[model samples]
Structure formats: C-alpha cells, structure tokens
Target chain A: GAGVSQSPSNKVTEKGKDVELRCDPISGHTALYWYRQRLGQGLEFLIYFQGNSAPDKSGLPSDRFSAERTGESVSTLTIQRTQQEDSAVYLCASSFFRGVQETQYFGPGTRLLVL
Target chain B: DQQVKQNSPSLSVQEGRISILNCDYTNSMFDYFLWYKKYPAEGPTFLISISSIKDKNEDGRFTVFLNKSAKHLSLHIVPSQPGDSAVYFCAASARVFGNEKLTFGTGTRLTIIP
Candidate 1:
C-alpha cells in the first residue's frame, strides 16, 4: 500500500511571503495531523482534522497558521507572512482511528526555508 | 513547556553492536509512547510502540522498554545494521475523544559505523 505523501519536498520563501504545504494521506484514514519541526527542536503540534473538520486548532502558533482537510485524504498547512522562525520541516501524519494509541503513518514532509 | 525530551542529540555505534536511545517525558497524563525512525529527507516510519499497561515491547531486533515510575523509556537495537542509521524520535500522547495530540522529543541521530 502506498504510504502518506507530501508535495514540494522543499520550499524556499522570502520573509513576509505566504507558503502552503500539502499532504496526501492514505485511503480510509479518518484522522489527519500537522506538526512543525524547527532545527534542533522537537515536533510541535499545529492542527488536526477528523473527517474534514479540525477540532483542535490550539496548537497553531499564531493566527497566521491554518490548515484544512478534505474528508480524510489531503490536507494543507498554510503559513502566512513567513518568518525565520517558521523555517523548518512541516510534517503530516494520519491514523486509521483516533485514539491514544492509534498507529500513525507520516509523510516525507516539506522543508521550508525562509530567506 | 517542552514535555518530551531526548537529551542526546546524536549517537554512533558499530555495525552489529547495540544502539540505545533514551527518552524522557514530563507529562503524567500521557500513556502511549511511540518510536519512529527517519532517514534523511524522508518521513518518519513507525518502528515500535508501547502502551502504559506494558513495560516492554520487542519487534525483531528492536526493543522498547518503558519505566512508568520514572516517566522514561528507551529503545534498544541489537546487531544494528547500516540501514538503521537515522534520526530516532520519541513521541507521547493521551487520547481525548477521538483526537490525540502528540508531543515529540528533539530526536537522536544514530550513525552506524560499518
């Protein structure tokens, strides 16, 4: 089976520009998640969607960050007015069922660099 | 606050030797833990996971040991192969309703010297 996939494996944007990262989850996955990984730092939760609706947007660092998922497949993480702090790998993951121990499959990630 | 922590930034081991990676968490509510392996420019692949009910879980040459009292867990790879060289991340989460939010560690880069 094909695993989760992400597009634009790498992106370089100037400060103040907006960038959108895309994620394609596996078929039948009902839950989708977005996370950010800064250099020398851990993964930070961004937003999560279940069946096309996001229930937890608390992790969004600021109002400039947003994400949307269509049904259970593709998702997009948009960062508005990019800053140097946003230069990092944006990861996407999906799980079959939403639970405390559901196994998650991850995408290759989009590495964004703000210049 | 950073809940999950991986103190060591990198580790090196000889081929066929054992590689140990440590992870610690401060969140007492988290009961599920997972370990992921990532290659350069690739997404993290699920390696193994342990629930709060169990103290240890093993898969092939990879073993994950958890100590609830200490809120610590470690992954051990025996007879490590060159293919196992990659960044290892430890993540934990507690489920609420159907959505579970995960907190990850800084990750440890493992290099196997063949």
Candidate 2:
C-alpha cells in the first residue's frame, strides 16, 4: 500500500517568504498530523486534524503556522513569513484513529531552509 | 520544558549484542509510550510501544519496558544488526487527558558496528 507522501523534498526560501508543504495521507486514514524537527532537536507536534472535527492548533508555534485538511484526504501546512528559526524538516503523519492507541505512519518529510 | 528526555544523544553497539535506549518523562499524565526508528532522509517509523498497564511488551527482537513509578521507559533490541543503526525516538501520549498528540524525546542515534 502507498504510504504517506509529502511534496518538495527540499525547499530553500528567504526570510519573510512563505512556504506551503503538502501531505497526502494514506487512503482511509481519518487522522492527520503535522510536525517539524529542528536541527539537533526532536520532532515537535504542530497541528492535528481528525475527520471533520475542529483541528487542533495548540501546538502551532505562532499564528504564522497553519494547516488545513479537507475531509480525510490531503493536507497543507503553510508557514507565513518564514524565519531562520523555522528552518526544519516538516513531517506529516497519519493514523487510522480507531479511538485507541494507534500507530502513526510518517512521510519522508520536506526539509525547509530559510536564509 | 521537555516532557520527554532521551539523555544519550548517541550509542554504539557491537553486532549481535544487546542495545538499550532509555527515556524519561516529566509528565505523569503520559500513559502510552512508543518508540520510533528513522534513517537519514526519512521520517520516523513506528517501532514498538508499551502501555502503562504492562511492565513490558516484546515483539521479535524489540522489547519495550515501562516503569510508571519512575516515569521512565526503555527499548531493548536483542542481537542488534547493522540495519538497526539509525535514530530512535521515544514518544509519550496522555490518553487520559484526551490528547493523542505525542510528546517526543530528542532522538538517540544508534550505531551498530559489525
């Protein structure tokens, strides 16, 4: 089966620019998550979307970070006014969301560089 | 503050030897723990997990042990192979709080030397 996929494996953007990262979750998956890993750091949760429920944006660092998922399919994470601190690998994950402890499958991720 | 912590940044183990990665959490609310492995240029893949109800859970060469009182957990790989060389991340979630989002520890890079 095809796994989660992300676009633009690598992106180089200037400071103050905006970048959009896309994620295609596995078919039938109802839960999608966005995370970012900074250099020498762990993966940080950014946002989460489950089915038609309201998205969880508590983990988003700032207002510049936002994500949208239509139904249970594709999702896009947008970072407005990118900054040097935002340079990281943006990762996407999806799960079946069976109301239990479900394993999250991840994508290859998009490495963003802000200069 | 980091809710989960992987003190060791890296570890090297001889092939066919036991490899142990440790993790600690500051949030007692966390009741579900998971381990993930990742290679270069890739995202993490689910490895193994242990629920707070159980002290240990084993699957093939991988075993996860939890110490709820200590707020600690460990992933043990027996007879480590070269293919096991990669970054291992420990994550925790608090289902009781109705939060499925995971809190991850800084990964531990494992190097299996053949």
**lDDT against the true structure, each candidate:** 0.90, 0.92
> Tens digit of lDDT per residue, candidate 2, span A38-78?
99999999888897463578889999988888867999999
TM-score of 1: 0.95
List the TM values for chain B, per candidate: 0.96, 0.97
For each candidate, give the interface RMSD after superposing the true interface residues on Cα. Answer: 0.9, 0.9
Which tens-of-lDDT digit does each residue in B1-114 have in candidate 1? 879999999999999999999999998988899999988888889999999999999999999999999999999999899999999999998864347768899899999999
**Which candidate has the top score in lDDT?**
2
Q: Is the docking of candidate 1 incorrect, acceptable, medium or high quality?
A: high
Compared with the true structure, the alpha-carbon lDDT of candidate 1 equals 0.90
The candidate that wins on DockQ is 2
lDDT of 2: 0.92
Per-model TM against the reference: 0.95, 0.97
